[model samples]
Target: MFEEDYKRRFVFGSDYGTSDYKYGPITLGERPAVIENRGYLPERSMVSKILGVEKDIVVGKDVAYFLESGADLSSRMIYPMRDGVVAKSDPTAWRVIKELTKFSLEEFKPSGFGFKGYYIVASLSAIAPRYMYENLINIYDEISRETGLIHASTIIPQPLAVAIAHKELSCVVVESGHGNTQVAPISRAPIRDAIVALNRGGSEANAITAEVLKDSGYGDLAKEESLVRRVKENLGLLPLNLDEAINYAKRNPEHVRAIYQVPGTRIKIDLAEYSWTRFLIGEYVFDPNHEIFQSYFKRGMPRPSDTRVGDITFYGMLDMAETIIRAVERCPVELQPHLYSHIILSGGNFMWRPVSTMKGIAVDSQTKLQHMLRDKGLENVNVRLSPEPQYAVWRGCIVYGYAIPANYRWEWEKMEGWVYHTK
Candidate 1:
């Protein structure tokens, strides 16, 4: 049997990227809140638009909503995690956490039964460094002192938790949230090889796409940051057929291109006019002429093989591939095959097929010296792209509380802090 008593836990995951702070709550077995219009009410509201229930039930409460008061508050809720590190390094973030805990209890309606415990599922990345671990503990302790809710601990790595939730082992986990593209090799039990790229993610791509569109000088349309993001999501990759794409950019700039429209603002562009800029943006991944490839190819150029596609020319693709390969190279030799077998990918950038498609080359480039060994046709080298790449980290953290064994609770508390214990 399991602990069956109703215990209110505040489950939250955050993507504190370079530009934004996003958070949401998670529930283990029951609805946590009766979500209302832009705010949650203690009392049940109308029927759930999706679940067809009389009360609008949300499985987990949201810290963003609580901090922003469901968009009702004037002060913006800011996430302090940046580059997979908490930026504030101060205690304010903890205050927000405590408030979120209070809100979660309100939503879950923990009985007049005195508060039993408060738990949180934080990112394993948050615990990677010793200093980060200590800061997190400080934050947690502060929250406990303010809120008085007891019982708290952190679970496994974010990617590992997600793997547990998906019941997927021997897979690649990628989380591209705000700042970094985090890759982890996951088996059914734990993470094997974890690698993170500092300068690659959705935000960078968004900026590149936006700048490209702006340089094209069409209308104010596609140049808008929001519009660029949408367009990049929709049709941002370099065309498989460069000639065809070039023609498309030239002749039908309006249809092939995009524009953004707000209530009062709008912009459009004829991408053909800014083809050079587009190509520059594409170089972030597909630049075959990059220093590394150019050096290698120049040394010994081979005639095009029938099975091989032409060498990649997109700069972005090349960088992504090279980075992954480099990281793979940095992995211990004994763990290489195991890590490759469990390539788990997450991140908003991974949403782009062009980015994911280069994984083989990226891995291959680094292990090129082991060409014979790699070419031996290892079928187990798999790249597992998470279904919802953006939410994986947060969702994983939410379930960590349930997935990990309880034996490590002390370490978790020492690193994170005691949960909010209300006397």
Candidate 2:
């Protein structure tokens, strides 16, 4: 009783996503605290001396201040995960991950009596290698030894965490983040052999938005990725059909016209005459191989290329519908319908809203996915976005850590259960 109660009070969850890190204790309730999953290594200078900055690396919210202070940010800043996987040789990436972990644990470290350490449940991308698991666990172990802030720790795949949080024991989870998308089928546990991944994601959409900005005479703003991404989230549209939406926008330009004023700034972007290009952003994200995109390619937009990382190949050109089909078909033939019927889209990339006036021309991600799947001849398909998609993985981690017993030791073959930091 005491052990379970202790866990209930101190179960901690950490989601190491590509763009942001979600972390907190189980008590965080609905959403975990988030910080950009990045780190800045400050260059030694007089300016650094004046700011009273002593640490070699900066993580969490203070990183923004350090970033704004320098122009050499591209060289100094590091994003640990690329397409959801981190390379072992990149010491900078490891440093960022380690610092972020330590910072998060320390931020919420309990000082009360009878508090031993947190039972941490951290999630990684589905395609992460054994070495990543080992490396991460080693970090936790080291942190536990030094700070005594971790009772035990374990790692689970992001898709499984999504499935667990969504309470879908037998379904497909299509997790899309900034750099890549993953389609993994789950039947209690993740079906490792059935996982399918795409090299396309939100970044691809941002790329198109940048091109559109250039074409719309906002050429100067096109160079700023953050600004372009903001322009995209505000002005982008997910069309039911690219051709149909473009035709409607061209005929009734006022209906789709969008202008986004950058927050806390004098800058405002108006995609006036080029409003028809809005559909291209979402269309390209879902299906980049459409014939119309060839012109963009010719105009110097980089194609999302197929890249092989470790033993997996992330298909860049596969349409969302085909990607789901490929992943579901890899599972047991009898289970295909079960997986198809309960498709769950989980991630920030799927966070889209429909315009009521546009009606049939524009739609939310869920409706767009259903249309695409229907076109692919998959009947009785029901697609829904994961509730609180941004924090689903972290919430799942909290639940997982709370349930697993302290006595069931961590095992390499099963890849579940706790690695006891203190006996």
Question: Which numbered prediction scores highest in TM-score against the true structure?
Answer: 2
The 10-residue segment with the lowest total lDDT in model 2 = 65-74
Q: Which digits, one per residue and each the tens of the lDDT, describe model 2 over residues 1-423?
A: 888888878999999998889999998898999998989888788888987898888999888777763357668888888877778999889889989999999999877688899999999999888999999999898899989999889999999999989988999999998889999999999999999999988889999999999898989888776687788888889999888999999999999998889989999888899999999988988998879899999998899889887788899899999999999999889999989999999988888779999998988898999999999888989999987889999988988888888677889999988888887
lDDT of 1: 0.45
RMSD of each: 11.5, 1.4
Q: Model 1 misses residue 331 by how many Å?
A: 4.9
Candidate 1 minimal-lDDT segment of 10 residues: 305-314
* Model 2, runs deviating above 4 Å: 68-70
lDDT of 1 by residue, 205-303 (tens): 565566555455633544344456665665455433334445555665554443334335443344554543343333333233334334323444321
lDDT (Cα) of model 2: 0.89
